[model samples]
Target: MIKDEIFFKNREVAAYRLLDVLPIQQMKLEDWIVISSSFGGYSIAKIIADTLDAKLDIMFSDKIVAPSNDECDIAIVTEQEEVLIHEELVKCFDISLDYIYEQSKKNYENNILSLINDFRHGNPLENIKYKNVLIVDEGINTGLTMMACIKTAISLGAKSVSVATPILPSASVQTIESIADDLYYVEKLDHFIGIDFYYDTLEEIEFEDIKKINKGLN
Candidate 1:
């Protein structure tokens, strides 16, 4: 267990630490859209958005039975919401469950390609232009999901895709670097277990609340 003092004192440090690791050049906060799923990720994204003076978009995967890709400059999500994103992809793409299961068996490296191909065939939006896209998550363990997120953004026509996280496992960071144009991580714990270990307040956000936040932003 993390010591209380270490954890509490680190909160403020962790808050601003994200900005230091992020490749600010690729992130024109004013022009990008930020999406977050988990409470931890959303909280951090909110801070980052405020710091960058960018628009924030929030979505609860539980309520979104279908994949609703909105018009935004960037997309950010938490690790837990990845499964929901995949589910939405399945429904939006009209792919068979058998195909999804089979494709999921492959390494995460290829899983990203699957999501992009699925998006291409499923939702074909017009006049979508995202010069820079960034996906923010609380932490990354395998990096596969991040890759998939990056793949989806690039497939949607983002010129450059980047990732930001509060904390990430070293191995996962390496994997993300391979696919992302830029990567930012606040902490690289040697024995990282999960994102929850680093946060004091990890709450569950409701879909209505997310919708409300989105509405206010618009």
Candidate 2:
């Protein structure tokens, strides 16, 4: 990490900063639905959703880590059973497709399902069909998880899928922009150590706090 290179005080500050750069005036805010990628992201997404007076929801996904290195994510699996693989990374690692699929199934059944049940009360996601969708995360590192959310939203019949994040690595911009209808971000860094590195306090959202947040969402 760069010496003392904190960008914002916390996710709330980041979300507010992001709102400054977002193209809000031109968008039909009423037609939009915001979906957060994780509980941590829901904090920022909720602010954006509330500010825009749009509906808010969360998307659940779990990373499929490399067999050799648990910290290395080879792909991501969404609660809806959608898998987004880093094909080149998998090939370079010589990871078997079978292994990836097997891991994805486990991630969905075990991890993703638990999150869905906890945050969403075991109910289905709010209807987003034909609605413009905005996917938000506090920050993005590899963009794999955000990509999974984008793809999942489209598959659920979203009219268009846009993405927003406070911080994003320069390398991921093109790849993410190619799939998303529009992308909004606060800072684009040449090198991002991790999402947590950019913020002073990007702490995990407690389960109890998450339940409270969910209760107020549409």
Write down the TM-score for model 2.
Answer: 0.93
Against the hidden true structure, what lDDT does model 1 obtain? 0.53
Model 2, C-alpha of 136: deviation from truth (Å) = 0.2
- lDDT by residue (17-114, candidate 2, tens digit) is 98998877766435898889877888899999888888888887889999999988999998888999999899999999999999999888888788
Per-candidate TM vs. native? 0.60, 0.93
Model 2 stretches astray by more than 4 angstroms: 1-4
What's the C-alpha lDDT at position 19 in model 1?
78
lDDT of 1 by residue, 1-218 (tens): 54752332333456577878765555653366554434346556766776766655432222222223332112223212233234545555575655443433332234333332343332222222565555676666645456655665566676676778878777787767887887777677777676666676544554344444444443
Worst 10 residues of 1 by lDDT: 71-80
Pairs of residues clashing in candidate 2: none
